[model samples]
Target: MHIDQAILDKVNPWLEATFDNETHRAIEQMMTTSPKELEESFYKNLEFGTGGMRGIMGVGTNRINKYTLGKSTQGVSDYMKKAFPGKHLSVAIAFDCRHNSKSLARVVADVFSANGIQVYLFSDLRPTPELSFAVRHLKCQAGIVLTASHNPPEYNGYKVYWEDGGQLVPPQDKEIIDVIEALDYSEIKFTANESLIKYIDKEVDAAFIESTVKHASFNTPQADKDDMSIVFTSLHGTSITVLPDTLKKAGYNNVHIVPEQAVPDGDFPTVKSPNPEEPEALTMALSLADKLNADIVVGTDPDADRLGVAVRDNNNRMVLLNGNQTMVLMTHFLLEKWRKAGKLNGKQFIGSTIVSTPMLMELATAYGVQCKLGLTGFKWIAKMIKDFPELQFIGGGEESFGYMVGDHVRDKDAVAATLLICEVAAQAKASGSSVYQELEKLYVDYGFYKEALLSLTKKGIEGAQEIKQMMIDQRVNPIREIDGNRVVMVEDYQSSTAKNLLTGEVENLDIPKSDVLIYYTEDGAKIAARPSGTEPKIKFYVSVNAAIDSIDDIPSAEKQLDEKVKAIIRDLNIN
Candidate 1:
């Protein structure tokens, strides 16, 4: 394959720069031996996306490397100097157990310190949520965490956080990107200010755990907590740093840590992928739960922002609960607790994404609380807390296995979320009901909603074009019917408009524009299509619900809903 001239133009600069000799040699070697790799590496500059600026580690403008991160940090420093305007600016830096995460974090610290910014660097690896807490706790202007979340080992990311302890949003994010792109690589400040850099460990860790225990631990009796058994695995990521401790402090004593998967390893040797959402990643934990007769099983992704859970069903079978199920269970428990305390005033609210199950809305309405929906990231949910200061933010989560309990930690915190879910399980177990039974009760109260995710990965330039075309094709010719349900409306986030297909009216959607489309059927079914901002893939979110007259109707109702989803998938031709 021939390398495009535009790509080559982006590549040639790194070869003749203040770039180190080793990087120079690698670039030249790629040029001679691997043209495809060379072109891919230099095709574009890394920019902020759904998960912030992330790419494979290598020597190029498009990759995550010392020079790229240094340049970005230098840009952040410049922006902070202007945004804060002469105040003593500081940033907290944290990393996960990913390969080279520590070194990359140190490199980031060096650039910030070199720019005369005060830096509080973690003494060792820590989860991403703790960094969010640290950002607020330290009263710093910004924070950075070196984590790719649950992505493969070949991937790593640099996610930036604002003073609110959430990822950068709107004007700030756009401005930061403008500043970074406008600067040259040589402008990066790499020399460290040793006096300005301080390493922190136990102080923040203690505060984070304490805060989690306080907020996540409902009043589950000590006897029930002690009797409830839990099997947990960190999935070779950073949760081992805090989850076990948080669970222990929250009164859960019968906790079994999966031995083989407990250590922090970036390679993730024990599983095919480190994502807790995927069932295979929790194989060892599930087995341990079976052996120990654990009441609930939990596993966390790398950096610990997302968690996967398992519980006993009505038939006493250990079934894994999807993200939507977990969201419903947790949100119900939270709202019910607040109501018992007489805290469900009108000003309180819970948050979720458009892709999540609509049952959250049911629960919110039942509690007389607002259910605010955002596009597909926890950062937006975090933004809601800042956007409306008067409203009490109880809890928020998405279908991606990430959740935020209260507003103490602004980001999706699996650490705290784990404890909250365990509280739900333990309390239910104590009440002579299992998590699955409680869910059936919710289905009986609210409507039964089941959600599914279908992702199609397309790599390289050809793949990118195909993914783009898929969205374009849908816009040109939309689906009108699925499983006998007529399409009533189509919401296009890219244009911030919703078209009523039945009434032939177009209304505006009040949210930020993104390349997402959702079709609402005349019935209660909803399906959405969107391309992944971080990965080279497109995702389709499908939600189908059924009516169960009673708990006994659950088995047949579930089968009917599954068939409906299958027919919808067949109609979409998503394969």
Candidate 2:
């Protein structure tokens, strides 16, 4: 492969004396022997998306290496100085079980301290939610976490959070990106100011665990807790650090861990992908649950910000629940609890993403609590919590296995979610019902909402362009029908407009602009197309719903919705 001049221009800087000898040797080897690999690594700089940056870890501008992380930290430091001039700025840092996470965290703290900023660094690996809590608890100006969420082992990431304990949004994100793009390799300060760095542990852990426990709403007797057998797996991530203790503190004794995946290994040896959303990732946990005859099985991602759950069905077989199902179960349980406790005064609301099942909105409406829709990421949900000061944020979640219980932690919290979910399971057991039975009751009361997600990954530079073109095609040439259902409305988030094709009218959508498109069918099906901000892929989300008259009708209704999703995918030619 021929290396373009632009790629060479980006790679030349690493050959300088400023970069370490190890990095230089790696780059030299790639350039000499692997021109194709060299081009992919140095073609362009890694993007600093709305939340933060993520990429393959290597020795290039496009990778998550020491130099790229240093530059990002320096840019953040510069922005902090400008954003809060003449003030003592401080930041907190945490890392997950990913490879080089601890070392990269130290490097990031070094950059922040070198910039004359105080740093509160975690003494050991911690979950992402704890990092968010530490930011507000310590009264720091910002926070950073080093983990790739659920990506493959070869990948890593840096997530930035503001004082509100939420990821960066709007003007702040753009401002930080501007500074990062303008920085040269020489501008990053790699030296450490040891005096300005403080190692924090135990105290923060106690506070975070306590806050998580307070979110539990279980009123079951001690006997119920003993009978409710729970199985959990961390997928070799940070959840193992806190979940067991949290569950134990919440009065659950019959808890078992999938020993194969309990150890925090960066390689994630037990699973192909450490994502709980994937069924294969939870295989070990489900097998263990089957052997132990456990009541419930839960799994969290690497950063412990997302959770996936499985429960025994009527046939007494362990079955995995989709992200939407988990969200629905949690939301319904909390809303009912609050209503019974007389906590619903019309000042409470739940949050969800637009791509999630609309059943959440219906549930909130039935309970007389507002439901707000954000974009794809949980950061938007956190931002909604900050935007609405008067309204109480009961809980919020997305369809990608991420959720938040209360306002304690601004980001999606798997630790708190896992504990509360177990409590819900226990409560159901006490009432002589199972989780699956409760879900059937919900569908019988409200409706059956089925959702499916299809992600198409395109690798490298050419793949990125292909994904962009796919989005463009969908935006410009909107589909008229799907599965014989006429498309009634189309929402183009990038243009901030919703067009009623049947009525020939246009209305404004009150939300931030993003490159996403949604189509609403006359039969109440919704299809959304959006590209991934952090990964090289385009995702399509399909949701179809039908009214269920009784629990016996669930199988047919589910089959119908499944067929509708398949038809929609076929109409869009997504395959």
TM-scores for the candidates = 0.99, 0.98
Tell me the TM-score of model 1. Answer: 0.99
Worst 10-residue lDDT window for candidate 2 reads: 43-52
lDDT of 1 at 81: 95
Encode model 2's per-residue lDDT on 1-575: one tens digit a residue: 56788888888889999899999899889988998889889888888663479999999988998899999999999999999999999999999999999999999999999999999999999999999999999999999999888989999999999999999998799889999999988999888999999999899999999989888645767888999999999999998888898888878889999998989999999889999989999998998998999999999999999999999999999999998998999999999889999999999999999899999989998999999999988899999988999999999999999889988899999999998888889989888999999999999998999999999999998999999888888877889988898999999999999999999999999989999999999999999998898888889999999998999999999888888888888888874
What lDDT is reached at residue 26 by model 2?
A: 93
lDDT of each: 0.91, 0.92
Clashes of each: 0, 0
Residues 282-329, model 1: lDDT tens digits: 889888988988899999999999999999887677899889999889
